[model samples]
Target: MIGVIKALYRTQLLSIKGIWYLFCSIRLVGMNLMALLYVRQKLCPRQIAISENGISINYCTLYTQSEHLAAQLAIHCDIKPQQKIAIMAGNHNILVHALFALARLGADIYLLNTELSATQLRDINNNVHFDWIIHDPEITWLPPINNLPTYHENQISVYALLTALPLTHQMKIEITHFAKITVLTSGTTGRFKLARRSGQAQNFVSPFFQLLVKLNLSHYRKIYIATPIYHGFGMATLCMSVLLGATMFLTRRFEAPKACQLIAHNKIEVVTLVPLMLDRMLTYSETRLQSLRCIISGGAPITATLVKQVLDRLGRVLFNLYGTSEAGICMIASPDDLAVYPTTIGKPLKGLCTKLVAKESAANMRNELYIKCAWSTGGHYWVATGDLADKDADGYYYLNGRVDDMIVSGGENVYPFELQQCLSMHPKVKDTAVIGVDDEEFGQRLVAFIVLASDAEQTEAIIFSWLKTMVARYQMPKKVIFVDELPMTEIGKVDRKKLRQLLS
Candidate 1:
């Protein structure tokens, strides 16, 4: 008994020492290394920065490869500082390297959505007038333009370029301003606009520090980013992983089963994704998802039903982040908040303020949410979100769909989200979207596009009957359209405008 006690004591002492050593290392070396990457453009020569598909690349090699490519761009491409360059590619090692290399060269970079068609791409370029286009070889749909150079991903392969470059430490370039990263809006409603980021340290520091404190982010060392890196949510997660000295696991595409497998295989502790990804992932057995401790869902409004399902299946790990391209992450619903108010977007983050401007009626108290944060556009104190929301007595905010999405049927206001929540409760419904469409009688009528569960046969009459029990008569969808799948934006929100276009 005495021997066992002594052994246990020794083991405890060793564990404590190990923790102290790790804490010291992270504070002393890890933080300095990250700062060096941002300020001095110096990469950690020996520390692993990124890992994908069981392959890893240290910061030194990543920097060297980026330097080689930057040199080539400077010589062959004649790309200069502050010139607008558009990059259209899927998430990969090449994309990561290109982002850093262009930043070092001080170019204004636009990360175009990979899902854009040739016509859309052309339209965007015609409006923005990019100086150069760097795209993946798979993007053959891009139209040719006179005197404008297009660099293919295969041409600037980091791995291939690294093999040819001489093994030597290259001097770091001093960029006065980090490359301004421009992300295009989802364009689900109408024309897409550029949302530019200055890439300043001060802009990210406050929110990042708050996130670290509130989300307990240090606990998550291995992260899997399931969203497209071109989007703000995905990009933010990537930057946070680098800042925290965490290992990241990424794939070019997101498949539910594959995502689950990757999470389990890689022991991914944190997963940042949209609600659609979570819904799809939950279709599989929960036993496959043992390693995930936190799931960050954002980029769209998640239904309460879906939130409950996630908590039940995946434990209380769902955290909903609410924000837009114009306004960065303003509100974040922690697991505790979700437990209390399932659909609440939670309170404003530190250094952020929110107010509701009543547009319709003061009695109703539902208003458009206006926010002011460090990341707001044009340094405005109050940036209009164009999204309608309701705040409870407890200060939790509930999104009531977009302001434009509200439909008035027979002189009664009907929010599509109310109908959507009602429809989502139906066990037969796999996915659902509600939109307002023009009507000859009513100013606008509600239309519901629903994807039913596999092997579940339910007629429109039955669904309408079920919905009648939940929502008001005026809120009933005038038309119920059955679809194999609803149109989704790149970030996984239902594309209401696209659905209306299809109906038209």
Candidate 2:
């Protein structure tokens, strides 16, 4: 009876602490909003803000560079407040500077994917009609546009722009409203569309609080962001690191071995990456990961097998976050949660609520997840995520797969994620992707493409025999094809579209 009372008391204390943090977060939002107006003058001179390739950029230098670039955008590029500008650049210091500069001008900045082909970029621009296109000279794929004015880093130098224009203590252009930042969804299944987010005060504070409280981001002195800056996962970490005055280490692209080396060299406390990156890092030496206090994983589905492997090799520091560009981070699975419910995506964030709505075709209790939060899009109370999920008796949610990815085989529904998870546990299988193919008798049949581990002598017959013990007869793949490597999308997800093309 005493133990039960103690446990109840602890739970109540935690709830009270959560409420206190929420109140503090809301108050900080208002303070940060006011600080946005005079952001340039609020720089800390001695603190290192960003570190890239052994070069450290202090907050004072970051402010001066951003100011100079803001002047160039107004005077040379003829850019005005509220004008639309598209930025297509890699993860570089210059790109970070441009982001702050554009924010200062209150320009609607569209962050284009650096991996997009020239044709796709043109197609997107044709529909959006951007006022200015600022691109990196290293991006050679972009075709010259005759009508729009394009500027490169060389042509628009902050130093040159500052020298040509008179020094002014006050901002030359007054921005009445904060800028709206436009981020694009990964168009794996369909064409990408813009997800516009107004530069509201709460927009910044919510993520900051979420990271600080959930991921213990504030305690980490150095952070390595391995994902692309154009995506939400990478961009959020960058912003949070800057706000906390933490040293940020960035790379133009993610290389597993190099990333591990950077973490070891810089004594990085926190490292944020997707599952694919983590899988590759696991192959390298585990000693390189000793300095890390936390490893944040998101932006893709992670299998139970991979989660277990991370815990075994790197200690219990993995955190899996589930979210989308349309809906901000909905759930977070901590290390303790994953130890019990390995596949669970954990509970909802403090201010968010989630419900499972039954899919029209699903015979089981499984349903599509609908999230309601302040950051949800579509101007509705609840945003249908289109991803199917189910909650356990303890209220931990587990993702089955996307609704569209569900396959009906012989009148039995089979989720590819389930099959993929089962196959991934096989020692011989390094990576796996499952897709449904047309079948005259069953309506649709599952096909799996697998990448075998190095020096593993497993054949198709052996894998099939092993899988029989792992999954149900109907859940097993109708056909298994071995591959050298799985095709990946620009954002590091399995390219199912290209995989289907390979089948054809």
Candidate 3:
């Protein structure tokens, strides 16, 4: 009850005036008018709502542009409500407009990852059977599908649509169907799975409130989403920023220096990024990031070293968010929580149920984490996160890497993250990742990939000797491969799959 009160206060929903305004806004949005127009009257016409890739658009322009774009889609493409359409593009103002436009048309939207291969895109299309595909011109490798209408940016003419007058009223398009949005899984280790969610504002209340109270998102008016919008983390921040009436700074791709410039120039108050991006951004000057009040890091694990660096350099402003594509957002560790335990993922959010399921015989060992939440893909039953975790006495959760990524060598289970964490403590080691491979004798053997510090002259023999002191003989990696750098996923996680392929 107290948590609810605090969330309400922090989100400005506790005051009578705030409640009344919210009530009015909800009522207006619930009416037959387009949903994006809810902010048309609330915000100033000249207030920039989106700034992406040198393009700035105010709320009025956003509404008008989306409306015009929706009309064009309806007239030219014969797009109808409930039709499943996939959008494959990076972050841009046109993509934002298309999202709003598609929402108004009540289309089942699938946000495709920009990093998807031609074959992966085809596989998704085979299952989804999309009515149309709207992609950017830069996506040149998209395979041609039979009877699937593909429209590039040039064919659509976004600038002309943005400059055109609003034709929604004249078009007389009746919006009776609500939309459902789907985001693809990271597919770092395996095939991609579609995580679906209802597009209603009511469905997002719990997660939004949790983030509002926990991250203090209501205070931030300038937000920089430094990750791909196709991913769940980026999509969530995009919706929340819009609901908060905040200005969003988006980029087609995340470049460390460019991100620093945007944040520094605009005085960006909050930023949503993956840990890899955060680490890269730290390589630049700290002065460029001084304006940040909240740095929301998610979509990948935040290493202890990264946590220490953030606290030491940026102060206590880093917030670590943990969730899966299937589960919206389960836990968030604040700066204070990290200060206490840098490895903790914090307590579960309000109204969320989390448990670690272990075997009856191995009750003391780490087990898979299960989450039951209103916003997750699992409606009522608990969903297995596939990631192994254990909770501390204080209810903070610590991840033990992916369950599939675990190695069973000589009848003993070995978690790669534990070995990686231990190996990273060496002063000469810059970065490291661990993977398991098939061994003729041990069934599976651990392989460690290392990136050494620039000034260090470290050898595999020295590191192996050092690691022997840290872990048991079975837990020690069979081989230590030195590399210039590790391959990273689109969201910045070390691509273990790629590492395994390197062995092949």
lDDT of each: 0.73, 0.73, 0.77
TM-score of 3: 0.90
User: What is the C-alpha local distance difference test score of candidate 3?
Assistant: 0.77
Candidate 2: where are CA atoms >4 Å away?
1-43, 138-171, 362-366, 407-414, 437-444, 469-475, 497-504
Candidate 2 positional error at 457, Å: 2.1
Candidate 1 to truth, TM: 0.84
- Give the per-residue lDDT digits (tens) of candidate 1, residues 1-504: 344334323323224543454345334323222233432223224566677777887766666666676665655567778878888776777777777667667788888887787778888888888888777666777756412223334454433443455536643444435558888885433467778877665677677666775677766668888888888888888787765556768788887888888887877889998888888788764677777888999988887778887888778888999987865688999988998899899988878888888887765455899988777665657887878888899989988778767778889877887788778878898889888887889888889999998899988899888887788788888889999877666566666667888786
Q: Estimate each model's TM-score.
A: 0.84, 0.84, 0.90
Query: What is candidate 3's lDDT per residue for 1-504, written digit by digit as tens?
Result: 576576566544566755665556444333212453445424445767898876787877777777778787777677888889888877778778888777777788898887778788888888888887777766766656422223334444544555556554578565544588899985443378899876666556787777887888877789998877888888888777766667889887878889999999989999998877887788666889999999999876777888898899989999998988876788999999999899788888888898888832463377899998877778778998888888888888988777767778988877788898888788887778888888999999889999887777888889888987889899888899988877876666677778888787
* Candidate 2 accuracy as TM-score: 0.84
TM-score winner between 2 and 3, please give it. Answer: 3
| Poorest stretch of ten by lDDT in candidate 3 | 145-154
